[model samples]
Target: MAEARETLEEPILTGNGGPTDLAAMEPDLLDVEPDQTVASGRRRRSFQFGWWLACGWLILVVGAALLAPILPLWEPGTPDYTNVAGGLSASHPLGGDAIGRDNLSRLIYGARASLLVGLSAVVLGAVIGGLLGIIAGYVGGKVERVLLTLTDATLAFPGLVLLIAAVAVFGASMTVIIVGLAVLSIPTFIRLARATTLVIVQREFVTAARAYGARPMRVMLREVVPNVVLPVAAYGFIMVGVFIVAEGSLSFLGLGIPPPTPSWGSMIAAGRTELLTHPQISLIPAAVMFVTVLSINYVGERTRKRFEVKDSNL
Candidate 1:
């Protein structure tokens, strides 16, 4: 008993043997709360920047759509019969096309067609390519080998070449354009989805979900797909510009959107004949196309950065 008491009573090493030394022994004596606050503040700033970029693009797109129909802008069929009077005037803000149709009006209406083709192509491509890619990635062995081989074969051909070939065979209608663009775009989505699936399927959460008797579809749709969709969505936005340009190119080649219907591509094609004489006809539509495509690309790039930052935070 004496020995145990002696051991217990032995002086504990306290700094300077002072009661204040107890304060020095406290865990995290250096304050970390400020550092934590700094980190949180940075996170909030990043989130705000990301949201602003995303929402800005969304609002722009929506505004364009809403303004397209309501704004008088221009009359579709009425050509500026008086060719002598050109340039931006009060009556003709963007001037008139070669045939005297209001350039501004046609441009506004053309947005409808351009946006439609872009959105439709994206939806079709994503659905078809994403499904095939997911299946190929998840079901390995012969299935994977077959699907990947097919994807490789499809991707080998140049997109523009394929589009040209399809336009030649099918003729240039909206449906044909959409189909051609979607088909040409599929291989890219397939590869993207497959790659994402390959990584996601191996994650511990997937295994945990599986262990809990979650069905394959549930695991894929609820767990795997949601995580992978952000990249796909970003890619879709990028693809919208590609589709718009492709449609325009086809129209410029005299095989797109049909005559009478004012497509941006058709407008550009019309202006090509008088490119030197009445440059504004072609220049105006080209400018619109340039701005639209540029804005879309910028938005896509910003979206990709935002997602990358978000993933890093996670």
Candidate 2:
């Protein structure tokens, strides 16, 4: 008992033979928290500036698109022979297209197609890809190998070419476009989810849960999924703009929404012939698409960055 007491009472010594000062060591160990707090605060503040502008643009475009049917705007399909290739005017806010369609009205209506295809494709792709990725990552072995091979093959294919072929075979329709774009998006999400899950599955909490006799599915759903989802979702948000742009490209190439239906891509295609005579016809829709994409990208970038900061802090 005396020897045990002496051993317990002995001061812990450093390599230099000096008694270890636990109090001095505490500040170094705890210093990370305040620095991390400051960094997180800075990151939070960084989200304030310019974010509102991007949000405002999104709200404006979305609101305008949703309210288009009831809004006091001219008919999108109706032609005004008198205003053919006309510039901005009281009767036509943005101006008339080469076919005399009200540009502003068409623009508003076109948003429906663009946003629908963009958002829908992204969501579909994200959900399917995220699930597959999580399953493949957690299961590993043959399942992981097969899934990785499939994803690689998909990624290797030319997206635009695949889209064109699909359009030709399936007929150019919104549903086809959405599905094709979603297919293209799947590989990307799968890659992201798989990578994230691989890291998360190795975390201590996951091991603890498994040790507690939790089922694999339960551990995956409750532990792995919650951690893997945020980054993947953040990335998906950013990809929405990319898909929107892809939809526009399809429309521009005459493989998007059918004619007589207004879409930003179709509008630009229709107005391209009148570029020299009435640049506004093409430029206006093009500008709107540009601004919309820019705003989405800006907001998506901010969201991604915010998530990255959060992950770093964790």
| 1-314: candidate 1 lDDT, tens digit per residue | 33433453334435566554444434333332233433467777876776676567556654765587677666677766883326787888888877677877787778778888988999899889888888778777898899889889988988778877777888768898898889888888989988988988999999999999999989988888887787888898899988889889888988788878788898899888888888988988888888778778877877787677656544
Q: Model 1 — TM-score against the truth?
A: 0.80
Go through the candidates in order and give the C-alpha RMSD of each one to the true structure: 9.7, 7.6
In order of appearance, the predictions have TM-scores of 0.80, 0.86
Best by TM-score: 2
Estimate the overall C-alpha local distance difference test score of candidate 1.
0.79
Model 2, 126-220: lDDT tens digits are 99999999999999999999999999999999999999999999999999999999999999999999999999998999999999999999999
